[model samples]
Target: MDGTREMKDSKQLISNIQAQYPRLSKGQKLIAQYILSNYDKVAFMTACKLGETVGVSESTVVRFANALGYSGYPKLQDALQELIKNRLTTVQRVEMANEYSDDTTILNKVLKSDIDNIRGTLEEVDEKAFEEASNKLLNARKIYILGMRSSFTVAQYLGFYLDIILDSVHIIRMDMGDAFEQIVRINENDVVVAISFPRYSKKSFEVVSYAKEKGAHVISLTDSIFAPVASIADNVLLVKSNMASFVDSLVPALSISNALIISVGMKEKEEIKEHFDDLEKIWKMYSVYE
Candidate 1:
């Protein structure tokens, strides 16, 4: 799966408002342009700093964020960070590839990057948000996973592991038509975990949209708050996949998936153990021991 397949959608609503806001004050327009054009910069910029650049009051910046459906400036800034962390640059890809010139270096770099990703993820991830998502997955009568291309791996891994850890985990990897067919069965008792990253796939986004319409709870894991799936999700898990060029780094995404699997398993340890025992018996019957 390609890295670009993982981006769910551009969910940054504030920026969208700036583009579509019918009657914006001059100050709001400036702030809006700066935010839309320099999202990465804005993510790290203080309200004062952003105001200084946009020539607006700090209060105006906060207002701009609120106007875009965010809680305030902090929420806006966090959204930017989430977007940048997922958007990959050409130079960065070359650097990542260059850094992994040898097998040993590749292993070390990938492992180290994954570990760093987990650390950063912990810092940025909202614990309450994750707990909510975990509960949704745990209690949902059915779970449908939608992931395309590279994200398909994450979705498949999640669905597969969760099937062992829980029950009623279904991974959707077929074409859009098949996805729609499966999604129609989803109801309030079901949950959809949509995986996408930068250069988000259109198919994945559509699936999430459809799932939401069916009243299924959505759990999104993607790069940006501005991503398409974010607004639709009941809970969004922002996974950072700093890329170098067109290619994305999956080590971080994999870490997030593993963590979610562990968390789900922990929540249903007894059930998971029973499932594992049954699976072991099947493996033995099939003589599939490795």
Candidate 2:
């Protein structure tokens, strides 16, 4: 689907709570109070856990979500998470991480959460957008890879693989000057693949807007349809990188990149095989590896 949908206002969750607070059941009021005071923890909790903490039954928690105009608890939880994701500070993030430090099974907890993120991504991904992104990447006269902060790692990974398979792939670098300088040459025949997640880089929107104005195809790799990058993109690839601690889990982001790369790489399999064969010979000659 084209990424032109109106951005959902996450703050509406707050207004909903305030308007409904007085009408809520006694147990629901307790839930609302905890959420206002400690949303970071509430965002990560299951409906059952939230109910227990708020002195209510799990069914009561579900009812609270419905009272807030959400169809279900998950929807309400998502609103809470989105509301706080970008507003979190470094100290707050560290505190979020400390919530798990007392557990002996932290490793299992983290891995399972990442696994769930991958599953959610698979369930919600737009196949049409994925295909469009792949086709655009293949046909572009040139490709610009853009990301910043933690997102840079995903951009770098995608750029590395795409460069090996496509001769026109270029990663936009911040160190070289302004981010716009690298993409100033973009045109209608070019494609811009930009990645951004919660705590998104403002630079992403600026660069992407400029590229779109210049007539380039824009592909956004991000966590939500509400993300600023998604609104300006020609294709939006949604992936869940749910928080595992202070940082988001990038396993889902990398998984989608792997899928996109393999999809594009297979189309040029014969040429890629020859290129790799030549690289293997050069590597062996130079003793690049033991």
Question: Which candidate number has the best lDDT?
Answer: 2
Q: Report the lDDT tens digits of candidate 2 across residue range 1-290.
A: 11121125456778778889999999999999999888878888989989888889999999998787676787777777777887788678777775476566678778888998998789779999999999999888999999898899999999999999998999888887998888888899999999999888888899999999999999999988878999999999988877747788888999999999999999889999999999999999999989
lDDT of 1 by residue, 105-145 (tens): 76786666567556657767767888898888889999998
How well does candidate 2 match the true structure in TM-score terms? Answer: 0.91
lDDT of each: 0.74, 0.87
Q: Which candidate number maximizes TM-score?
A: 2
Model 1 earns a TM-score of 0.65
Displacement of the residue 208 alpha carbon in candidate 1, Å = 0.8
* Cα error, candidate 2, residue 234 (Å): 0.9
